[model samples]
Target: MQPQLLTVPAQSGPTEAVPAVRPVRFAGLRLVHAALRRDLARLPNALRLLQPGDEPGAEALRRHWDFLTAMLTCHHEQEDRRLWPLLRRFAPELRLLVNWLEDDHHNLDHSFTRTTTLMRIATRDPASAWSVAYAVEDLAARLETHLRIEEEQVLPVMTSLFAPQSRVGTLGELLDLLRLADGPGAPDALAWLLEGVAPEQIEALIAECDDLTARQWPHWQAVYARCSAELWGPAATVE
Candidate 1:
């Protein structure tokens, strides 16, 4: 007797083949690049909120803070779990860089915590907003520099060392982490990243989600839609 091949029903809606999972080296760099752009764009708006006014800037600042905190935390977690171990295995010479990166993460966390505390204070006492704004600005500058160092010095080494199989596993790990960390405001943060990416990069990201489940699809769509509208005005739309 011939064995019958079991077939699953196709999901409804726009579906595309999932691209090969991004390489670990490339994925790390892309994630950081996307995140940095979002934070930089929002920094000005957040700073503006500190200005003495009855305007709705406070809400904006709070939202920006929430987004940044979540993104940075998730980024660091991915590095700690996926990136660092692979680096230790592939390029042991770069252990120093990993150490430095870890230290920088701690330093960045301190700055973020300080900024968050001050922002909370400013909520009730608008007079204190300037101090919080200054801290946030300083942190943003530091983070930008840190990202550049990782991109230039660290990622290339990783790209050279990680095997293709490892890269696929690492990419899967990253996606799992992001899904686990997704909160009420995650879509907004993702939207912020999406808006800053070039057209081609946007297509790449969509391609990354090609195999996403039917349930996960609508959540992402809603997130992309709402975030685009809020951050980029009416021009924001998923392509």
Candidate 2:
């Protein structure tokens, strides 16, 4: 369900800390933002290889675009389904900001769709390579803006709301929220999520994952490592 932008509650001082049985703090959100930034930063280089005279294979580029789109879609869907409603309920003061984030999601969806269309065209018509590259670059610019705002404003609000002592505090809840529909079994998505996250944060995320995720993670890491090297060249960072 969508948020009601109107009827916002008045901001009354600091909210009382709700007691909790198990106080677990989750840092998945910040790490996800970092992952997005890393991908966006590398995107320009990926696209640059597609300049008019460049010889990057169209099919390979299309696959790369598809992987990126899938990862981003999964991240946004998880936030929309699990994060926003919780924010609206517990952090009433951030209601307007939550609504704005929802709006940002919609805008990002449009950009993704447009970029995908360009990618498809480029797949069939190599002459359209520059156009596809331009589209991706544009998407990166918009995504970067959205991400900066989210990290600076929304993340702190989430940290305060989900503090360790909070009644709602549970790493499981946030970890589950971070999960995509394909679950933790999908190597590409998992790799993308872990990319650019700090070592400690990765440990924290792994600690909160289910048994199956923990069991499969090492194997998937190895598989994606090989795939990344093949796709981005040996020197490229896998994440």
Candidate 3:
């Protein structure tokens, strides 16, 4: 699916269409914040499974590890391609933060790889799981801190620095970049956003995404449906 470039709305005209929800640009960042929160909340459960002599817990840890690997890797990749470059251009004073984020991405990737490798070994050789679990705990701690910093500092900067129209454009670029990197999960991430957002906010997101290719819409819709079912069950209705 090709990502459509966002159209710049008139800056000063009162006659311009008032967006139905929060602009996609800000909505996207809020989505990321929610995801980070969700993942962090799951860390303790993951860590408990890693305790020594807990075979069942070890298996549980492995499951969480796989989920985190997929989610965090996708998140970091999207930021590297879409958010960082634009931040560099629009907020050069934030260069340090961007660089640190990039470094953290590498750190996270390394930790995930290491933890995955250990998980495979531990699955086959139970004694090995404890060692891997300790490493994962460390990684989770770092990740939690990183998430807090990004949410508290980075997101606010993004909200304040970018114009509404430019923010929407950047969001389109970010989504497109993620689609290239993670395929359907890019939209899955979008669906994840819907959980934390108000209905009105989602309407705005859908409008912004409408700027993209028609093909992308199906992918995003599928993601929303899947996540809604998984997160909220069959009874959940998506606006």
Candidate 4:
């Protein structure tokens, strides 16, 4: 099952009971998860397109895979360094859950390494395509479980901690902390995250951007769109 990315508030309870934890908006995390799901869903097909004699398709798929790896690694590193520590402080009771998520990160890293290695092999020997496909499938399965649990356990806590009234910090500050990257290929990565997002969600994200970023956002979108068309030619929809 897909993890519900939206933060859901806890319901009302009795007088002596702990107050219901209200859900906080996490536009950034939700956006990231959506991109992860959509792009990952396409990896197997992308790999299949790279038969032994197809150098052009293989190169394109490799570029796509490289970008995906960067985005995923950047995301996990941000959370490990910033998000998780902040969350652990507020939800000390969730220590076990936090530990599991960290472990999942390690596991997923290993999965990415294996998948990348197989993909590299498949590039030279098309006979290795099946092996690459299996690796991709295995990675996807592991990610599915990790994302589900992360959405269920970790995201809610992040929302609660970042809730405006909670005084932990503003969503804008949280956005800064969770930024995926700012160097080369950053726009494509950002555009990738924004893919298939609802208009309202886009509006919400843009509203949080600084003036310079807001102005430059469209440029990034166009750049990534062009790159996407080139990478997934004639595929009508990349998502």
Candidate 5:
């Protein structure tokens, strides 16, 4: 069940009597999730392209993997610290589901850690790239499941919880906080999330974000473009 990445709000079906999951913020999430799904879907092949003892190639991939995981960690922490707590507080009935999603984040982190370890090993011994590739594939599969659950079950609840009249800060506020929080991979994170997004949408999203992102958008895009093409090769679409 692929979540369509669009600004148009779509109903995820209500968990109780909540708003439909149609908000700009949710669109931002869907965009990020879409980028994750598309890129990771192709990651195994990219990993496989590394030749044995190709230290340069393995190191390059390791750098790219580190960037990706840094962004992933930031996203996971946002959900864990902010989103999940609100859910547990307001919707006690969905505690079991919330717990599962929270567990997924932690478990996914462990899996990501394993992949990082393998990436380091591959950097030294490129023959181990095969193992790293399989590890990524496993994480990608789990992520597919996790993202689907978030869309299917959590969306409606979140939509209701963060309704317009609610006193809680908007997604933009949280993003602003994240930007100022000295978060890891901030520029790279924006670049990664903006992948495959339209130029206009990128502009709009950046407007909702920070001046730093707006000012550095082009540079971020350029860096990511070069790094991604070098890592994933011509077969992969750089944008």
Candidate 6:
């Protein structure tokens, strides 16, 4: 199933007062979450497939590992540096839950480091693939639990903050606080979100972009198609 890049909680509350929902307003965050979830679940099986010394496949997985960690680090850094701090200021009641999530992020590091190490070894020694698979599966399990909590507890508060009556943070301010803007790999990162999404849905997302991004839509797709093909084989190509 394709993730809905943009989100409105089952209830929009006051945001409905706005004329339209821009993808940047909420979709950027959800897209990052979706991409993380997708890769965590996928990496274990992908590693298992390379147990027979498939060096090219292993290298592809390694590049993707770099992407996954980069995204995860940025997401956590922003949440810790920006998003949680905002919640701390405005939604004091959520402090305990937010703290737990923050701690969870730090606690996952041991397994993350182990998985990263195993991934590098697997690239050279086929026998190490199982080790990588096990490590990733464990990491995925922990991350899934973390994401479930965030989606259930944190996101609703975020959604409410977008309401018209909320004085603390407007959507634009929240987006800025989260620092969802482009940095290194910005194009590929945006392109990463659209992979495997339905064509019509992709068009809908692009429609909400600003003029410059709307113009660059084709190039993003081409880049994603190439990346997908390399990571998952020819079968994964958009064509």
lDDT on C-alpha atoms for all candidate structures: 0.60, 0.62, 0.61, 0.66, 0.70, 0.69
Worst 10 residues of 5 by lDDT: 16-25
TM-score of 4: 0.78
Per-residue accuracy of model 6 over 51-140 as CA lDDT, tens digit each: 565677878888888777766776777778777898888899999999998998887765677778888888778777777788788788
Q: Would you give me the overall lDDT of model 5?
A: 0.70
Q: By TM-score, how accurate is candidate 2? A: 0.72
Q: Estimate each model's TM-score.
A: 0.71, 0.72, 0.61, 0.78, 0.79, 0.80
Looking at candidate 6, the ten consecutive residues that score lowest on lDDT are 166-175
- Alpha-carbon RMSD, each predicted model: 10.1, 9.7, 7.5, 6.8, 6.4, 5.2
Candidate 6 at residue 224, lDDT?
76
Model 5 ranges off by over 4 Å: 1-4, 8-23, 164-177, 180-183, 234-239
TM-score, candidate number 3: 0.61
| Best-to-worst lDDT order | 5, 6, 4, 2, 3, 1
Superior by lDDT: candidate 2 or candidate 4: 4
Better of 5 and 6 by TM-score: 6
Off-target runs (Cα >4 Å) in candidate 6 are 6-25, 51-53, 164-183
Candidate 4 ranges beyond 4 A from true positions = 1-24, 165-185, 234-239
Q: Would you list the clashing residue pairs of candidate 2?
A: none
Q: How should the candidates be ordered by TM-score, best one leading?
A: 6, 5, 4, 2, 1, 3
